[model samples]
Target: MAHSPLDPASSLPTGPAPRVSVIVCYLNGANFIEEAIGSVLAQDCSDWELVLVNDGSSDESPAIAARHAANDPRIRTLSHPDGRNHGVAAARKLGVDAARGRHIVFLDHDDVLRPWALSRMTGILEREADVAMVFARTLYWAWDMTIGKEEMESSFAPFPPGRLAGQVMLRDLIRWDTRHPPPCSIALRRDVLLATRGDGALWHGMYEETALLMKILARHDVWLLDEVVSSYRMHPDSMCIKAEAAGTLSNETVSRDRVRYIGWAARHVAMDWRSRLLALTVWLKGEAKLRLAPRR
Candidate 1:
């Protein structure tokens, strides 16, 4: 279905452009879209616009998003013009293209951003001119629980409020770190995102954030915010779970993704032979573990 011809934000008097553009992507996510939009609407920071990309879902997601846009000027619903299921990367790229904010943050339809998430993350980017991305901690919310049952706390990154890390360290961490920020818990500069948005085909249409993060790290410093600013719901219906169910989460797929990441890193950033070798070894070990681990 086509979006409304009339602009949703036109009714409200125009003001200065928003400081943050929140891009949420979803396909057949009617079950959790409302809660996700509610989290964004409930943000303590008011200077933001919600760009909801429906991704041509064959469910109620587009309708729900349209209804939300009708009520709130800050929310805009969009979809692929062809009305087909392009992957998350393409959907996100479309949202980014339509965004009009200085900073950008991505929210998964099944996830949530805490009240202070926008204010806290954007403030860091503003204060630190050198920092290209600001990522925070996330709470792992079990499907049955109202609140997060466990904190996906970081033990490897530099501590407390925040810490800045350079390209070399960030690259190493991605290849080897035990705990790192997921896309849901991070905000990035719009220019950088646009410049590095490679085709969405990496990893055979998986791990889009991994490619984006590597691109960001190649040229910019990353800030690790120790505060928890989002909740990542762990449910069987998640994309990862579905992939696992389809037997696509095997070592072969993981290795292919790792190879793609290494090649991308080599092109963008010059890492020494040792670092590259270390990264490959780490991937091998992880794949080995996955092979040995019992199925759920």
Candidate 2:
């Protein structure tokens, strides 16, 4: 499943390296829109496009997007015509469709990425001959502006034959176990995205990025960046932190998704028993926490 780099500029309207589409999908993130856009603008690397998709906002979001668009030619906004297409998933789909760059960056509007996030990520993508996506370590920026340590750092293991994830799936097993999920640290190739036709339904709501990651793993290798190339804002307004506080996704859903995920991995993916069992164990632990959280 190793793909030759497709000219790095073979996308619909743009090429690689210099041109980038840093997509920031949002609902009602008017409060943080400027900060988010500014993060991308502050990048040391120039020649990037900003695709901002507004998913039916009731507040000042549209105005905010317009204000930025009016000033910057590289920035553009698309409003969700149908109400059904207004969630995170739909907004993401729209963002991907609107992207013209060969390299696609997925960023949350409420989250602030680091100055070198795109530069470093795209650099690795160019260097790594077999990588499908490049993921960097992110720093935790508290409300007090205190940057905490990196959450989950990868081994940065080189790709095994036929892309490590794809082979695991080909063997009928799951190859990934997420101790935690970080949204801002991921950057992907446009062809890898075009392969999926920019379907955000996989990443529609809660575990959207998780689903997207799985799809990418199907055909390519995810190269982990040891450097903290992005910064994630921690606060009460964040949807994920709120979900954790309310115990909405809680644990049961996670446990079930794990079973389903591994099943999907083992059934459709090509992997063996050992990998399946390991994935199962991880899911079971998550289930235990889910079942206990309510009582606690």
Candidate 3:
């Protein structure tokens, strides 16, 4: 289906521009898509738009997304020309291109945003002129009642809650010295996101967010929040879990992806001598980790 941008004159409710555009790209996510959409609907901040990109779902998720869009004008659904599965990164790019908000928030189909997520993050962005983005802690949720409490907990980054230089954060992320911000927990300026696009058309496989974040950090500073703003559901069907089950989560695969990420960084992110040195260090560390890790 042909996807069109949200027309302010017709598609949106009469008001100021949406403060945030929440993008949820799903592929056969019928089971959890509703809860995800509901979380966005439940957001205390009403000044937001929801774009549900149907990434070639074979199940009833398209219908679910359509139903939600029918009930709420703030929600719109989009897909590729032939409704093909173009991977998460491409679907996200499509959503970003069509988003009509000042800021962007990426919510996975299986994840839920807390009610205060948009308000809290957007508030920081508005007040901090130098900050290009803001991210907070995320709850790793074991929503299945059968699961134990140990599996359900909060994840906090090592960074303090305040504005931080992008280069420093980027280096830490590459070196695996800190917990990177999950996509669900981040809200970034739309303009900054567009500007941060690297040489790649779409980051293939995993580490897509890493590529995007590295680009952003190379150019701007970001704000860190101490509060938990989203819940990331831990389930068997998650990408990492599935990869592990399929034997594709091997160190070899991860090392290859990491190498690709480092190469992308070299071209698009680490321009200065110091940054390049950090990239080299990260590469050496990755090689050592790969060599030390046991084969699947």
Candidate 4:
């Protein structure tokens, strides 16, 4: 049988694979690319490979990534041909296709991983066979709020630390008990990710990570580490911020798309009709709140 591009068992180069593949996807993020790549290099666990995907960046991002790649044998770079910019999801797929690790984690060019992140999460995955995904808390460091101010005053974890630790099932995640951690904070078994691959175009403009998370959650329970493993930078040019500024993403659009995502998840994850109905009800109530909300 011919192997699919998404298949982990496909004919990849034969060699010693890394324990973890840290994929940092970026475009025109020259200012923060160094810091993002630096965080991975500074990891406590050194048995990892850094895959830097340059999605047709016009800035010094490609140059910086190349410099780092030249200096470190563990770093490899990939880019979209012809210098045409592909969106985030396509960039991610490129990295995933070239990954050579047992476990995989996605990092953005603007985020920074804590020094202990790799060792801690990989440790948990190694120790627990049942846990398909392990995610940790993130500290949202707002750039506008942090500039010229004391570092201590700038960042915060929106969710209380230690509140949602331990193994959580798919149903629990769907309940919306807490915010879903960003892609940077979560690590997954590579095989599991490949098997649940969806049409990358579906997530081109929005909800990329959410779609992937829902699929992973469907088949296996995830572990939540109480510690903050990464820092998510929130700046004016960030994707969500840009969408909001352009009026392309509104409360109504978000709610409606979420309901659509829930239905998609229910169908693909093989959920029973009862669970699907329950998910529908949850979103309906959420939609009601948006309707009742006062206009700004």
Best by TM-score: 3
- The global Cα lDDT (0 to 1) of model 4 is 0.72
List the global CA lDDT of all models.
0.73, 0.64, 0.79, 0.72
Q: Taking the tens digit of each residue's C-alpha lDDT, what string does model 1 give over 92-143?
A: 8888988888899999999998899999999998898888888788887777
Which 10 consecutive residues of model 3 have the lowest summed lDDT?
3-12
Query: Model 3: which residue pairs collide?
Result: none
Comparing 2 and 3 on TM-score, the stronger one? 3
Model 3 lDDT per residue over 1-296, tens place: 44343222224445676989999999999999999999999998799999989888899998898888878988888888777899888898889988989999999999999999999999999899889999788887877644332344444456678998888887777766225667899999999888776444535576778777877887789888989899988777787556556654444344545666776677666455788788877777667777776766
Candidate 1 clashes between residue pairs 3 or more apart in a chain or in different chains: none
All-Cα superposition RMSD per candidate = 4.5, 8.1, 3.7, 6.1
Error of 2 at 175 (Å): 8.9
Clashes of each: 0, 11, 0, 0
What is the per-residue lDDT of model 2 for residues 72-119, given as tens digits with 9 covering 90 to 100? 767777766553335777677777877778788888877787898888
Task: Report lDDT (Cα) of residue 111, candidate 2.
Answer: 77
Predicted candidate 3: what Cα RMSD to the true structure?
3.7
TM-score of each: 0.81, 0.74, 0.86, 0.80
Best candidate according to lDDT:
3
lDDT of 3 at 257: 59
Tally clashes: model 2.
11
